[model samples]
Target: MPDKPAGMRFKVRNENKNALGGLATRKQITIYFTQAVDAPSMEVLLYLPNHVSGPVPAFAGLNFSGNQSVHPDKGIFMSDRWINNNQKGIQRNRATEASRGSQASRWPVETLLKNGFALVTAYYGDLEPDHADGWQTGIRTSLQQELNLAPDQWGAIGAWAWGMSRIMDYLETEKRINSKQVALTGLSRIGKAAVWAGANDARFALVVSNESGEGGAALARRNYGETIAQLNRSFPHWFSPAYKNYNQAPDKLPVDQHQLLALIAPRPLYVCSAAEDQWADPQGEFLSAVHAGPVYQLYGKTGLGTAQMPAIEKPVGETIGYHIRTGKHDINLYDWQQHLAFAQKHFRKKAKPKT
Candidate 1:
């Protein structure tokens, strides 16, 4: 969105994948920016389904921690970058052995590979650490003045969303990956980034926002939970400075979250929320999806179609899907199950045919 990266190239991939027991392969791909030659390069942790033949669709997401934290595979490279000190297994802002697979439950790797899908993820810290001053060590400060905005320009969310596009750039070049079926996904703040990425880039075939509150799928006009004012006060660096202008007056804003969802249009979009995560306003998110249905109808596609939120754990919709699961605000296996089903239905993707 803030102009494509100068260039993106992978350093290493598909090496030593046999160790995964033939079921799958994990490779670490480092992406370097030609424009910001000196900034820290982003690392992509990719898992290709060896069980599938030919190119396969993939899910590219930005993780909360380092790649090593996603899975316990000892082969996964530990991030050498700075991370939130409070994160489990992170010692002195660096990931350690104990950090491996700490968040594995959040990712259903085995199930995904069995279903014939590839998973691509990188630590959000790769582009810029999730802190106020993170720009100094990220591509944000390394890039030209245009990218590093003052008050009205894209901020961390914009940069991270741009990174998702860059990942798509690399995916387009890989024969083993079906670039046309790729889905961009994220949870919480990262989920917000995923939605924004989908709005700005059309390369992504699908998008998933898991409890991406406020600036995400949740309707800002409702002002039900996680109001705009609170979001800005808590995480000032997450959105464009221009967004803050309406922090206290969401109704005054010309557009709302539904417009953002509409941007994905006839393309498949899934909005998820949790019953207990009131801070994300599950109801508001459902309404946004409901309102976005008209836009989808313009293309002869379906949306949530209902003003009422579905029963907890009951997901509903076609082109635009939504669900409020019975849990707190976190991406779990259930969330993946819904998104996978949504992607499979919209993309017409099925398990790889038996040889």
Candidate 2:
């Protein structure tokens, strides 16, 4: 694969380290997004499982509701986003009725910890909601006036991916983590962020796109279930104004999702889909992965191991990992299992390792 972009090749420094206990050697830092003001304080959540006797690989992702909703842990700050939850966003001073435990089955924290991997997450709503004027409350609010973002710079998708990099800024300080071994992963809309984050940040060792449809892992040109037009129409703030011009006009898109996958190249990337999730276009996702293989070949790393989609629950593991499980549109134990197995295989303990 071609060398990573110069801006993404982050260099490490020695002082970026801290210790919690003798065995729990790690660092934790919070990056404050002081620009946006529609809500209260919003921050990323991180747990360095590397606090064990040795350094460990990690998975970084975006949470849908809020950081506090991911786990019962009190340490995670409550989100300030206008979530659909009864207790928090709706119902005034209470979370939304339909929002409780919505994603518990998706994020298997205990299972992940037992497998010896660190898990870090952030709230996508903290960056920008899927609505118009979201840019007013996102990273775009902090952009330097001198360097105005082209029409594409400050969309909801771009804002969320920018939030992911801010999380990386904190990850670099945690000594317990093999910073270079961190894998970026997400689901649905956040899955799109993960793909963009990995494409933009080379320090992220692996990129996993789980049901990221439309502009995500799916081939945009394929008239899929959730077409580009629907996304732009429903969530006009999600992409730049330039994106709307090509609604239902996939052929005119400067880049398809396959090229987005190619942006990751030699790095490990896992594209997951669900058998029943026709709305997300599973076949389109698989084909995009297949097309990106030529770029991976540049660095002697094979991309997807096959051209045809595999049987349900049949995972194709190679430099590129893929599996279409028998389920609806959501993450589950099966997805986590595949990700852990893949991480262990590629990010195993290095010989005479040095962090």
Candidate 3:
């Protein structure tokens, strides 16, 4: 993995244990660079299971809306970060009071706590807004200057992925979290970021990509659902300039999604898709996982071993898990159920010698 960016600093801005109906403790962490005073700062929200006896494993991801929208907690701060104007409960690129708990269905906090998992998340817009000119207002604008990176060196997705690693850095310093058992996850575009983050950072014990199609888990060569052309047109700022060259000639691209999946070899990776979300190309996502099996075999670990896509609602694979749940392009309790089962198999700490 790439070395942590030099001179990165973290501070606990605010922390409150009495949160989430007394089921979880909330902490807000501020991360910034010591040298880049002008850089935008990142604030991450961590919710630890209050009842856990020890440091609990956590699930980290980028949220589409502000952190307050994840749950109905009056104490949680609402982000002023620029957001997509089209997102639910967001108006004029800002989140209002009505936005709280708007996305609670996707993030089942109580359920995750009951299952012994902490939830760590931050608004993706804090790192980079979802617009072509967003770099001016997000972390990337300052990071590019600090690192002397070219315009094409990285994109919004890369910035979001790097933000995940920074969050991991903070988790490593906290005593209430098992940094080694943290899983990175995302849905849709952020799902793409989760996969890229997992591939670039080995510290994440598990990775889950929910409907991260096209530029995500789906094989780019398949040209099925959202193609390269469509992605570049719709979200040009998501990838590097080099990626756009393959819009019409994907076959000429040196790397495919399988290679990206291979980068997570031996590590437990879960790629989920929805039957009704044809735009994400469920078949291509499964095929990419199947192709990544060889890389896993090199480490004596198994990947999704089947070539044919399994029936809807039936999950498959061992170390590399996948499922095509019967739904649309959204995350739900069913997805969390599968994620918990996968983590239980791979990330659960071993018993203490049966003493």
Residue-pair clash count for candidate 3: 0
Candidate No. with top TM-score: 3
- The order of the candidates by TM-score, greatest first, is 3, 1, 2
- lDDT of candidate 1 vs native? 0.85
Quantify all predictions' global Cα lDDT against the true fold: 0.85, 0.72, 0.87
User: How well is each residue in 1-355 modelled by candidate 3, as lDDT tens digits?
Assistant: 2345688888788888888778888899878854466546777888998988888899999898889889988888888877777777788889988888889999988888877789999998888888898777666666665666754677898888888988898999989999999999999999999999999999999999999999899999999999999999998899988888999999888989989988988899999999999999999999999999999999998788777789988899988999999979999988988888888789754322110
Model 2, range 140-235, lDDT digits (tens) per residue? 564424225543555778778877876777677766677888889999988987898889888899999999988899998997789999988888
Better of 1 and 3 by lDDT: 3
Evaluation by TM-score, superior candidate among 1 and 2: 1
Candidate 3 residues lying further than 4 Å off, grouped into runs, are 1-3, 35-39, 349-355
Q: Which lDDT tens digits does candidate 1 get at residues 243-284?
A: 899988899999999999999988899999999999999988
TM values, all candidates: 0.95, 0.84, 0.95
